[model samples]
Target: MFMKWKFFDKIPVEGGVSYQDLAASVGAQGEIVSRMGQMLVSTGTLLQPKPGSVAHSRLSLRYKTGNSNGSAFAMLYDDFQPVFAKLPGFFGKYGPNLPVGKTNIPITFASGADGKLTPWEVFAQQGTEHIEQFGLAMQAMTGYLWPHTGAYDFTWVGKYAATNPNRTLIIDVGGSFGHSLRANLVKYPNIPPGRCAVEDREEMIPSITKAHANDPVMENVQKVAADFHKEQPVKGALIYFIRRCLHDYDDNDCVNILKILADSLPEDEPQARVLINEHIMTDPPDREVAAIDIIMMTWASLERTVQQLEKLADRAGLVVIKVHRAGGSSLGVLECKKASRS
Candidate 1:
C-alpha cells in the first residue's frame, strides 16, 4: 500500500504525509489506510510521526519501489498466503508427516487438487503472471538468500573447460532461463560457453532463447529441453551442475536425479564432477535454515545436511569428493564423482 503510493519516498525524515493526504492520493479510505499503516508501524517498518501522519522508518525506506528485490517478499506473501493458511488442514487430512507425493503436497492440498497435480502444475493453471513473479523473486533471492560470491570458486571450471573445448564441460540441470549459468560465464570467462549447456522444460526454451540474446556470453550456450528425471541425452559431460534442485524432491527422486548425472559421467574421466549447490540443514538448524525447511514443506521438500547429502550421492552410485564451503556458511557445494568410474 505504501509502496504504491510512494509514501516511503514522499515522507521526509522530520515530517510525514498526513493520513488524509495519503488516502486521497491513493483513492483509499483514510481510516483504512491509517489502520494498515498502524500494522506496519507496529512491526518497526513504518513510523507514526504524529497521531494522523505516517513516515518511512529506517526499515521502510529500504522498500521503496526503486528497490526491485523487495518485490520478492511481496510476491511470496501474495502467492503463498492461501497455501500457508491451509498447512494445518493439509497435515490433518494427509497425516502430520511431511508430504510424500509430488501431486499431493500442501500447495496441491490447498488448491483442493490433492493427488491430482504437482505444485508446478497448480502454478501453471494460474497462467504466466505467478511464474513471472516467481522468476523475479528468485533473482532477488540470489542477492542474499543464496549469495554466489565465493560459493565454490567457479573460476576453476574455466580452466577445466579449456582442457577439451569440444567435450561438454557443464550441464546445468533444471536451470531456469540459464541465469545461473550466465552468471558463472560472466565470473569465469574462460569457461567456453559452447562447451556448457542448460536443460529445462520445452516450454521454457523460448524464454531461454530470448534471454540468451540479452547477454553475448549466453549466445553459445546449448539450451537443451530435457527432463532431469528421464535419460540425460548429453553423455560424458565433465560437470553436471544441479543447483537448488535435489532439495525440491523426496529422497528417492533426488537419488534418481543424481544417478542420471552419475550415469552421464565418462568412464575414463574419474575426476568428472557432479556439483550439488544447496543449503545444509544443520542439527537444531539456525533460524534461517529451519524457517526455509518449513517453507519448503509447502512444496513437500526439506533441506539436507552434509551427511544426508553424502548418503544421497552414495545411493546414486556416486561418492562425495569434498564439501566446498566458507566458514559460517550453511550453503555448500558438494563435489561428487561416479563411484564405479572412480
Candidate 2:
C-alpha cells in the first residue's frame, strides 16, 4: 500500500528522489525482487529518477481520487484484493506463472504508431493466462476484473445468435476453449447446437474439450485446430466472430489474418459477415478507462480508432457496412461485408 500510494501520489517534476533512493526503499533482495523490478522498469512502472543512483526508480502518475462509487485507491484495492486473496492457494498449488508474484507487466494501450498492447488484449491475455497458470480461482479474478459480469457482452452476442434463425453456422475464431460459445448458447436457448464452431490452437483443444465434458451443448460445437494466419477452413460462414482477437496483434498481422478469412469466403455469399467485437478507443481518451491504455503498451497490441478500423477493413477487401455499439457495453460490433472488387 505504501508503494502504491506513493506511486499514485508523487510526480517526477523538478525535484524528485534518485533511482538509488527508490531501490533502497523497496529493499532489493533475491532474484524474484530483481526480476519483479526489471518487469516494472520494462513496463514503465519504474524509471530512473536521477543520473547514476541505484535506489528504487522514482515513479509518479497523474491521478485524482474521490468519485462517488469509489476513489482510485478503492478501485485498485477492489481490483487487486481478489487476486491477493487467492494468491496463496492458486500460486502454491499451480506455480508462479499466475499474476500473484509481483511479476505482472502492466499494459499500455497504444492507439498511435508508438505500438503497444491494447487494453482489451492486455485484459484478455492476462485473464486467460491467469486461468492457465492458477486454475479456477484465478479465472474468478479475471472474470471479476475484466469484461466484468453484468456488462451485457455475452447477452448481446446471444441475441445476435438468436436473430439468425436459419440455423446459421457461427465460426468463433480464436475463441478461447468454448467459453464464449457456451455463454452465448445459454442466452439463445432456442438456437440449435450444431451451428457453432470454435477455432483455436491445437494445444488448447484437448484440455478445453475435457473441461467441457459434462456440457451437453459441447456435442454440437466443433473444435477446429488451425492457425488464424492461414485460410479459414469453413467457407461462407454465416458469421465469423472475431471478438477481442484482432487487438492482440498489430496492423500487418491483423490484415494477414483478415485476408485469410476473406479469401475463404465465396464472393457472392451475402450471409458472410465478419463481426469484429472489440473495445474501440474513443478519439479523445476516456479518463475513466485510461488505465487500459497503459496496460496495452507492455504487450505490443493496440486499441484502434474508428478510422483505423475502416482503413484496415479497406485493405483486407472488406467494407464496413455498419457499426453497432453493443447495448450498454464497452465493445463495438463492426458488421463488415466483402468488397465488390474483392
TM-score of 2: 0.55
Pairs that collide in candidate 1 are none
TM-score of each: 0.82, 0.55
Mind giving the per-residue lDDT tens digits that candidate 2 earns over 1-342?
Answer: 323334323334444444444445566434444455456566665554544321233332322121212233443353344444544554454455422111232222122211344333334355543333222221222233333223233344445557755544678888766565666667667556677788876666776677667779876688788779886777766678776777756688888888777676656556577877666788576553355543332344567777787888889988888887744455666777888643
What lDDT does model 2 reach?
0.56
Question: Model 2 RMSD to the real structure?
Answer: 15.4
Query: Cα miss at 75, model 2 (Å)?
Result: 17
Poorly placed runs, candidate 1 (over 4 Å) = 1-68
Worst 10 residues of 2 by lDDT: 105-114
For candidate 1, write residues 148-209 as lDDT tens digits: 54577777777766666668988988887677787877888888888889898776777777
